[model samples]
Target chain A: AQSVTQPDIHITVSEGASLELRCNYSYGATPYLFWYVQSPGQGLQLLLKYFSGDTLVQGIKGFEAEFKRSQSSFNLRKPSVHWSDAAEYFCAVGAESGAGSYQLTFGKGTKLSVIP
Target chain B: EPEVTQTPSHQVTQMGQEVILRCVPISNHLYFYWYRQILGQKVEFLVSFYNNEISEKSEIFDDQFSVERPDGSNFTLKIRSTKLEDSAMYFCASSEGINSPLHFGNGTRLTVT
Candidate 1:
């Protein structure tokens, strides 16, 4: 089965520091990757997605991710983190079975804590 | 922006009681899904519905769970007999088509005592 791995369980960084959360996935073919952010009391919000095309994709809230096919990795990154960016981040891989039903397989999220 | 909406933000039910969680997907979305997350656990896919029928379901979706699209705008998930292990935050999501990003609702917190 296709699966996702987010190696970092929790990451703490200074407010102005650069941030990178690593993700690796195992899939049979070209994978569809996504990054989602969840605040303490809010629903999961789509940060960005990569179905195909450019290796780097930009998303809302100053977020971007790079899909490295050879490494089977798609890591989320930000140039300068803000206190508001302290939230749980999830990496997911979109999969489609032969039946044409599609679902997202999510990794164990990485909780980010930003210190001012 | 259009979004999926779920009702009864929080529901408390007895172990053997039944509970129904409701959702109204984005107006034009054609694919619907239900996912659940136990506290401190990864979000899991439960089932996917399309064309008024279930297209796929995970092992977690067994005989006890059922889904319905009774009307044009309503989608529902019913647990016939809730169990303690059923306590989790259930999310409803929808997408325009295959390969589209899923838009999730705020989620319904189910607590079975």
Candidate 2:
């Protein structure tokens, strides 16, 4: 079975400050990783995804993540965060269930709060 | 850019009543899925549909739950008897291919009283 763990339950950062959210996964093979963000009363939006190739992947809103196979981690990072970037972020792993169907197993999520 | 859309932004129903959540996936997408997130839990996958049939489902999707793509544009999930535990935000998603990134809808908040 595949699972994702986000170590941080909540993180608070001031505007213009760097931010990093930790994510670790347990999978038998090379895994497909993704980052998603959800604002209050909104749907989950895909931030970025990693299937293969580059260890570091860039996403929308100036976010990026590095896939570290040695550590089983895909940590999201931003050089600077804007106030609007505050939201609940989730990390997930996509796995093939069978018959070519793919499903995502998500982490508990880390709630981000921006300080003025 | 194309995106998935889900209907009935919010639905409140009695515990024993039935409920149907509808979704219109991206026009050219071939695979569709249903996922749910409880108030403070991780998002969980319920089922996946392709070729007008269910390709996979999780344990949470049991006998009381069902899915259908009655038409080319709409996918629906039906719960015969809603339980209190079934209340959650239901999300619909679609992808162009097996390995393509999934585009998700805003989600329908279902509340069972």
Candidate 3:
């Protein structure tokens, strides 16, 4: 079974400051990774994903993540965060095989608070 | 910019009552999924459907939960008996293809009292 862990339950950053959200996964092989953001009372929005390619993947809103096999980690980062970027972020991992063949295992989510 | 849409943004139901949550996925999408997130918790997958059959489901999706694609544009999740624990935000998502990224609906907040 593939599981995802996000150690940070909450993150606070000032506007224009760099931010990083840590994520680690336990899987037998290379897995699919995804980052999702959700504002209060809204559905989750996909931020980025890593299937198989360059270790560093770029995503919307100037966010990116690096897949580190050695660390079993895929952390989301932003050179600078905006006030509008405040939201709850989730790290998810999916296995290649499962009854829900493409089912995603999500972390507890890190609530990001951006201060201006 | 077609996206998934869910109906009944909020529904308050009595315990032991049946509730149906509806979703209209993107026109070109093929696979459908349902997930739930309790207050202050991680999102959990409930089930996945394709070709009018259940492809996968989680343990949380027991005999009480059922999904249907009654029409080309509608996908529905029905809970037989609403338990207090079932009160959560339910999200519906769809993907264009097997490996395509999924688009999600705003979700139906089911509140059982």
Candidate 4:
């Protein structure tokens, strides 16, 4: 079984400030990682996904994440936060099951609050 | 862009009543899935369907839950008897393959009263 953890329950940042949301996963083998964002009453929008490749991957809205194999972490980062960036962010890990279907295990999520 | 679509933005059903949630996956996708998130909780996978059969399901998905592709286009999840714990935001997703990223629907908020 695989699990994901987002240590921070809520994060607050001022406009123009840098932001970082941490994520950690427990898996037996190399796993797929994804970042998703959801606003109130909305569906999740994919920020980015990492299957296998360069350790650093870029995503929409100027967000990026670095995959650290040693730490088993895929932390999302943004150099400058904007008001519109405030939303609930989830980190999920995907792995192959006995059925050979890829299933995702999501973290509790970290809520971002951007201050004007 | 092509996206997964789910009908009934919100559903209010009484306990013990059967409720069916509908979804229309992307036209060419081969895999479909159902996930739910309780208020302030992580998204939990319910089941995955492919080729009109269940490929995988979680412990949370019991006999009381069922999924079907009634029409060639419509995928549905039917709960035999609703429970208060079933109240959550149900999301449908589809993907081209196992490695492909899933495209999710806006979600149907199920409120079991």
| Model 3 agreement with the true structure over A3-76: per-residue lDDT tens digits | 99999999999999999999999998888899999998889899999889899999999999999999999999
The residue-by-residue lDDT of candidate 4 on A12-100, one tens digit each, is 99999999999999999999999999998889899999999898999999999999999999999999999999999999999875444
Question: What would the C-alpha RMSD of candidate 2 be, to one decimal place?
Answer: 0.7
Question: Candidate 2: what's its TM-score on chain B?
Answer: 0.98
Tens-digit lDDT track for model 1 on B1-113?
88889999999999999999999999999889999999999999999999889999999999999999999999999999899999999999988877689999999999999
Query: What are the candidates' interface root-mean-square deviations?
Result: 1.6, 1.1, 2.5, 1.7
TM-score of chain B of 1: 0.98
Best by lDDT: 2
- Please report how far candidate 4 places residue B81 from its true position, in Å: 1.1
**Candidate 3, superposed: residue stretches over 4 Å from native:** A98-101
Which candidate model has the greater TM-score, 2 or 4?
Answer: 2
The TM-scores of all predictions, comma-separated, are 0.98, 0.98, 0.97, 0.97
DockQ head-to-head 3 vs 4, winner: 4
CAPRI docking class of candidate 3: medium
Q: How close is candidate 2 to the true structure, as a TM-score?
A: 0.98
**lDDT tens digits, residue span A19-81, model 1:** 999999999989989999999878899999999999999999899999999999999999999
Q: Could you tell me the lDDT of residue B84 within candidate 2? A: 96
Deviation in Å, model 3, residue A99 alpha carbon:
9.5
Clashing pairs in 4: none
> Across residues B42-90, which tens digit of lDDT does each residue of candidate 2 receive?
8999999988889999999999999999989999999888999999999
